[model samples]
Target chain A: MAFEIHLDNFTGPLDLLLHLIKTNEMDIYDIQMVEITEQYLTVVEQMKQLDLEIAGEFLLMAATLIHIKSRMLLPVSDEPVEEEDEDPRAELVRRLLEYQRYKQAAEALEALPQLERDVFVSRFVPTEIADSADETVSLGVFQLAEAYYRILSEVPAEVFHEVIREPLSVAQYVQLVVRQLADGQRHSFRRLVAAWPSRAELVVTFLAMLELVKMRLVEIDQVADYGDIWLKLRVAQGELAAVDLAEDGFGYG
Target chain B: MADLKRLAEAFIFAAEAPLSFERLCLLLERSRPEVRPLMQELLTEYSAGQRGFYLAEVAGGYQFRTDPDCGIWLRKLSKERPLRFSQAALETLAIIAYRQPMTRAEVEYLRGVDSGGVMKTLLEKNLLKIIGKKDVPGRPLMYGTSRQFLELFGLRSLEDLPTLKEVSALDPELAEAVPLEPESDN
Candidate 1:
């Protein structure tokens, strides 16, 4: 029974060739090169007619098959055969067999009781114990400065200095940081400070971040070595007021 | 006196990831010699096939998994879309799993098709991982099957994979020509 093979139906040319061989029940050990080549070419022609994007590998195999057929057609000499002389079909046959083995292995893997597919494990997850195991290391002053400097380099040098009508206060910047992380998400330290329009405000915000950390109002954590420092609130937004920011002596200007 | 089997069972039951022997020992505060028998007993009890779920020694650890037949009903309840593997994907995965630490070019050579897309899909699925770059001049990144591959396939380890059957009655010379190592093809 003849069948129409689509491009998507087979993985590649060798797979297609195997299918052809299996359908015809041709002996793989002794592949009838002439017959199989004709059948393979016909399939390729059909694929072309259907406008299927036949892979170059298929054409390569087609050429190999024709070459084998032509070699087989050549008259044989009566001279003694050498020890190392190999059949043109030998390499092709070896590859087909090798491919067939893996194809079977793939079938075996498919048949196994796959996790999340044929079988399932318990979805039970215990309530997380307070994660003292948090891998985040406390951000050091040096690392924080390095991160701040990286952000500073990206911001263009200020074109004109504005009059210091109202100096940027550490306390106000402290409140700004608390508000930024009030959503309880880890905001990148560089990204948070980089929002300021000028170098002076950036420096004031950096000092405010240090002030907040000292007062235990916010925590700076580096999740990985040399990774970005993240600023997150140590206390809830309501508790930020209770933290004696005044006691820390960073008075609001 | 703590029933070690019960404690181990509880740990395995509650664990999302497979509970390893080392972790179990640490959790139980028991010596390896003491824990080994209890774990074996637990495994044996589950292996009797009397329970709804059995303890599977997968990915070098123990996990409680329901029978494969129960998946149909489980899928209905959970509505997790079953992971589908295409012919190409399966073949590509098989090649990598067996002859892994090989390159995409090598995989293509075996499958006789471009496998970059297939390998990428497998890598995305976490079944394959880049072990390291091959020491060759181009230093192409080598790929290997991940622990997730074993867990998904219900294999305890790579050693748990079924031994590939020898190709029967093949010429010794032709057999020798089947190069397992990546060779510099001229």
Candidate 2:
């Protein structure tokens, strides 16, 4: 609450929009642009009156609002509206919709069991406490997301040192892996990536295997005991060369 | 017809859950530049007022699913009396998957559940493990997910999951298909 008052001075554009929406109880979809524009302009007026010079960013938003206001004022034609000729509110609506989703996501995150040391310590899972542990031994190695998150926190955010400017791409990593695995040599998963220059490279290389798994590019297995985990390329270099061809067949488009 | 490709249909068919751009590209061996716009175009065209089904990303991969209106049919298909997953299970699973090698006490604290039994079920299901023991006061055991999870869900890897929005978009069928349960299984 204290932060809200202070943030008003340096708040971002979305914050302003949200403020206006809350204050006026404005229906976001059917906003009274003229009224909103008036109030918005008044804020600028107040800032000027207080001798607090404002940035051009707010002014730009004001101008954009004015333009949209004029368009909203325009009369509807008898001819059907083209998809492109829809209300200027469309883009604004899109952003508002997106922000709404983000808001909901943030709320959902709030409800999540925010745990310490990977264990939830809240009154969160009472209903799920029922156990049926009369079963067999299980083998799972579940560290991935948090592992990366920790890695992200520990690594320097900005790598100024020009270790390797070019990213170790998924495609190239796959090639390196396929060749090494094809050479009949067992590659230690831990040892294979030890020489990587930096953390991001390590991440990119890890991501490559993940991509391969998605693409059915390789088979990863861990036999009984703490033996060296194995990853072998599924096919030859020529078969693997169908990178572009994948787009043609299974392309997202 | 040579230039025309039913890429969307193909993606839905192959993916385990709902897929993301990065996952899709890896699956198709394409770059973002070549895949994103085309996927957008295809998504718009395919889902334009369609009723029986919708394309969306969920969990971490894509799959063709029956329509939401047809959820009653799907509900019937699972044949477990629509046994909704327990919140404790979902919470514990999400916690373990997101933050793993955790101890039983750590899970109980986060879930606020005496998760000894649920942990055991997950263990029996081969979905969890005692990834060595912590050298703490009680020397508690740590838990994590198994590779069976990826295989069971038909995912090749964890990177297959899109962001939340993309996941929802990846599987609008399930989005609409869902019942009004208080908590969705994570």
Give the alpha-carbon lDDT of every model: 0.79, 0.55
The best candidate in terms of TM-score = 1
DockQ of the candidate models in sequence? 0.23, 0.02
| TM-score of chain B, candidates 1 onward in order | 0.86, 0.54
Candidate 2 at A219: error in angstroms? 76
Name the 10 consecutive residues with the lowest summed lDDT in model 1 chain A.
A133-142
Worst 10 residues of 1 chain B by lDDT: B174-183
lDDT of 2 by residue, B1-186 (tens): 322236545755554334566766765676878877777776675562385555543334444444444555545444345323354455566556656778988765444336788888877666676687898888878887665444333333555422335222122232232232242234
Output the lDDT of residue B134, model 2. 92
How do the residues B92-185 of candidate 1 rate in per-residue lDDT, one tens digit apiece? Answer: 8888888988887888989998999988888777788777789888998888888789989898998888676555333233233222223234
Model 1 earns a TM-score of: 0.66
Q: For candidate 2, what is the lDDT? A: 0.55
- Per-residue lDDT over A1-253 for candidate 2, one digit per residue giving the tens place of the 0 to 100 score: 0011222322334335545554556666777888877767766665676676665656777887899999988887889787768778777656544543443333333333221211111122233332332323332343454457789999888957766465345556655655566654556666667767577767766766666667786777778678656676776667776654232343323
TM-score for each candidate, following the candidate numbering:
0.66, 0.30
